[model samples]
Target: MEFKGKLSLWQRIVRAFESFDSWTAFSLNESGRRFGAAYARYAEAMDLFQVRGAKRVGVEILGEGLTLGVGGLLVMLALALPAFREVGGDDWLKKQDLAVTFLDRYGNEVGRRGIRHDDSVSLDEFPDHFLKAVLATEDRRFYEHFGIDVIGTMRAIAVNARASGVVQGGSSLTQQLAKNLFLSNERSLERKIKEAFLALWLEFHLTKSQILKLYLDRAYMGGGSFGAQAAAEFYFGKSIKDVSLSEAAMLAGLFKAPTKYAPHNNLPAARARAADVLSNMVDAGFLTEGQVYAARRNPATPVDRKRETSPDFYLDWAFNELKHLSDDGKLGGDRVLTVRTALDVSIQKQAETAVESMLRQYGDSYDAKQAATVVMDPDGGVRAMVGGRDYGASQFNRATDALRQPGSSFKPFVYTTALLTGKFKPTTIVTDAPLCIGDWCPNNYGRSYSGSMPLATALAKSINTIPVRLSIAIGDGNPKIGRARIIDICRLMGLTTPLVDTVSLPIGAAEVTVLDMTASYAVFANGGKKADPFAAVEVRNSRGDVIYRRDRDLPAPKQIINANVIADMNGMLVKVVEEGTGKKAAIPGVRVAGKTGTTNAYRDAWFVGFTGNLVAGVWFGNDDYQSTNKMTGGSLPAMTWHEMMAPAHQSVELKPIPGVPTTPGGKDAVASASGPKGFEVAASPQRPAVLNPRALDAIGGIDSMMKSIVTRRGPSAFLEPAAETNLFGAARSVGGRMALQ
Candidate 1:
């Protein structure tokens, strides 16, 4: 057996050796060795020849040229990356998705925004002088070169270097069109690279006349006008086809800096710019000196329109709302729409006038630099919006864009939440003492609290601690849970601004916009219905087909708040205007309900209220968040609200607030012993004992009366007394027994 095992192992080894020899036979042959040697010799000869050849030609000529050529191509591709990313598909050339024209509530054309593709006028219709003037002034080499004119660019650089400033622009007309169509006005290296590449793309795909036509049709020509056709009608009150030589020159001059040389705003500067255009025309050999002399001598004059004031802020917000509707597919993908908005131009003018006059009269005294107001119907149709003192100075719409602390005005939401719990009422007794939640103690506005009062009086007085205690009490001792409840209620009431969850949120630490606050209050004004503010009433396409209608397309306002809860909240709010901090906002005959909010350090003052017909909110503060000079919600904001609203109700039949009692003549009914239970009915000491209804009919009657009272007693006049005075002349002091009427 041992012999057989050794023999088997030897046999296995022999077999393995045989297989290895078979596998190696081809590579080990003489032919394989000869081929390998020949390849080695060939590689050595080629290496030697390459080294010699490289040395014979200079390194600069052979190596650097190829390297630089590759590097230049790579650099060009890198710079053109943005252009490639911008034009991902064929639809890139379609600049505007929707062209819109805005009409007011009365069907009067207010303004036009967005680019109307159908309004494009062909280059064939443009007069020779108009075309020549545009080319000579904007781009002298529009037809002579490609997208980028190297000669014109060099000339512009030389001229700018000689002048030590940018006296001329180097961008060709196609480059300008590229920027206008696809890029923003941001000045940066990346944007310029994108602009240059896009210009080349446009030139390659479009004819010169097409590029020029797009440029004329898309450029912003100031005064809210976009394109030459709109500019001609706005400045000359004529069509582009009918404009004379001088008028065409003036219009061409606006392409450089429209706002700086708008004829209606500054005629002398516009004329000076037009004269420069005429000189360019003469220099470009497009016209003779004598031919241009006529234009320079006569000088174009834009039509007089100084008295017209465009509702730019309102139009901006409406346009934004329309865009949202289009994005939601509610407008049926219509590229061109004529929007009929709910803007009442008269009320808009009134709102603007009130803001301007208040700033002019008291802005300096109060150290306030900006103010904003929003007016809407109880149904949530925005009628008037004043974004700022001047829309021309700033396009930022404070009424909708600015998120400000609503101060005590936010307390109503807390109160509404508390009332919705069914455990709290307007007259529920609550202690108003110093409150501390995990060492974050809050105090009353005066830092002194009334020991105990009705829930209605606490809100009317704008006490800070009561809301904090209520926030905790309603949440089963969890303030955070209570705050969440309040936020939920605010959202249901039509406020869209994000509310912060914090201990101080009960006292208006959360930021909100004026438009939202006003619309939320419209819930109470319209009897607990949802009042999500809307601007567009109807939208029609370019073919006059109805695309969207508010009544047909949108769901009717739902009852978001319980009717009983709304009534309870409205009662308390009415008490505020009648005898609490919002007394300055009260109209003699109309029953007004609202709340006053003053933030810490007086940085923000807000008074949002509503009558039967109109709901308005007013905010006064510095744009930089600077504190005013002891301004409170009751002082200027309430006064401004009263100023705008008192006149608004004169022509319309007064409506009634949902839960407030009113007499037949539209005056709030005198509270009696039979008034609603669990609500305080009181007379403010600051109010005149007897107000003459006839006196309210005169101009500035309410203003003079309110001003005299406020001026005499100062801001303290609106402060709640430590003891409440019932309508029957009975006094119920804090921490004391209630006195029945």
Candidate 2:
């Protein structure tokens, strides 16, 4: 409060002494005096002779301990941040909304993928013996400890220390579940820390029984099987609930190493592992010697499924297609779907057999370690795919995933682009001299060049310099523009791999996938239509409601290649198969057209070809990109293609390739000629054939027109025509560009 008037000096001093500020200052002074006295007494006590140094050292140690503890905690939090980020918002726990069961074209059950929420069995459904076996081997103290299992870990550490090696794993089942759910199978201290933290998080969110059930349902049990239920069915042809004690032990043994202990693959090893599991159970008090003796005597025998080969590579690709369709909103959000794919089981077996047989026969000699094959119909429906010789050895899906240089097999695209420019023809003479673009020079396969020859002959012989020369000539001496044109053609025909413009691009320096190469060749096979590769033909919900049908949902394949270009390209490719490097790819009574490609140093060998009915591409190489022993496209890849295609056409009605004359049995008409001169004269398309009355009648009526429209445009033919887009959402036009009159 303000004073009303100035006061005398004595009155002012009294007012200051009575003010609140004076009282606070007096209390602070008194408290400081008392604290000073207490500190003095404490210092005196510490100065005592017996305890002085000890007390000082203890205080320092305590301070250092707090600092180090806090720093270590911060470090741990830093490491745990990534694990927490991996868990991110609990979305990882949500079950997949889509579970798909794949069926072949003939409606046979091929395989199933994705999580089926309805198919998961509870922990109570497992037999007691199986549960005991799993616990005894994987983690005996699972229920007694937190997710870390400190006691079991310590015991395992002691045992391993005594053995001087890692004879036992200290991770709990929960930790394994964490790795399965969120982490890769990497071995590092940071990975262990992340695994431990994630295990703790899982324990916090999920109960013990939930963790057990998830472990049983999600663990991979090999033979391409996942989960205990799938493993039981795949190995014993019975439900997990109905499995015998011996079988249960064997299944439990797979938890350590599924591929190694899989009963279907190695019965003796599987039995030995099961015996170990029994011994573990006895040691853990889950069973007695008397109880385990019977299991040891009567080992489980897996059912004979050696002849049954699931099209695993095909299914993997089809599943990816299904996901794409779902993402594109073509298939609604149905939890369960039955995908009817265009997989021909017979053809798939033939393809697998061909690849395996070829590798077994020539792998050692040629040093070719891996091969990838893809077969699709002319309309782009994938029929059969062999990604590797053995799926169990590697699930890499080389057919769809690996990108290797197409070598001379890519010459067709360059030639097709040249023909599309209206400047090149099959008989156009091209010089096959040493070619150079800038400082880069490409030589012929044998390091010898023919002076000049018809374009068909150059391609038939796979003269490397010819394609390079053509690429430069087509672009008016600018290989970049020519390479871009080739790339555009490849994209138009459904090659999704990104291509680079290089000096050698025209001669197959750019890398491409087997699937796309096969699909690109399909454009010629289908008479100039876009051949966008596809796998799933139909899909239905669990209730059998049609969610997506290829014929009903997809637009007609657009004409992305000109008719003249296709004819020229097909003629050149046919010449390659008939009397050239790709002769080994020829079928006796079939009109086969294809090109052979071998990259530098024989690092990649390819044969991409097609008949009127199907298009197939084969590639041979090592996964490590090692060069084979002089392996050429005309050898192993062509032989494998012929091996598969010969059997694939046995029962089907043969169709003739466009612009190629064929007999009733689909044999090349030129093949019956006596010499190359007669073959060349017969193969040249000098004039169009006259249409017969029956052929005209078949395509003339209004009903025929409507039928053709409906077949091409699907049900949408009754509706308005919308702008067509390719898989990448680019508006598709005729011939992949402005139509030429």
RMSD of each: 14.8, 12.5
- lDDT of the candidates, in the order given: 0.82, 0.83
C-alpha RMSD between model 2 and the true structure: 12.5
Clashes of 1: 1
Q: In candidate 1, what are the lDDT values of residues 249-350, reduced to their tens digit?
A: 999999999999999999999999999999999999999999988888899988986845888888888888988888888888567889888887767776
Residues 1-741 of candidate 2 have per-residue lDDT tens digits of 876887899998888877978889999999999999999999888767444567879878988999999999999898889997777675676534467899877567998776533446667888899999999999998897789999878988999999999998999999999988888888898889999999998999999988988888877788767688878888898888888889999999999999898877788999999999999999999999999898899999999878456998998889888888889988876767998888887778778877887788789899999999999899998989999988998999999999999999998988888888888889899888876767898888788878989989989999888878777777887877777778888888888988988888888999899999999899999999998888888899988888888888888989888887788788888999998998888876778899999999999999999987789999999999999999999998988887777766654456788888775545332222111221111121111222222333333343454666678878676564341223113222222432211
Best by TM-score: 1
Q: In order, how many clashes per candidate?
A: 1, 2
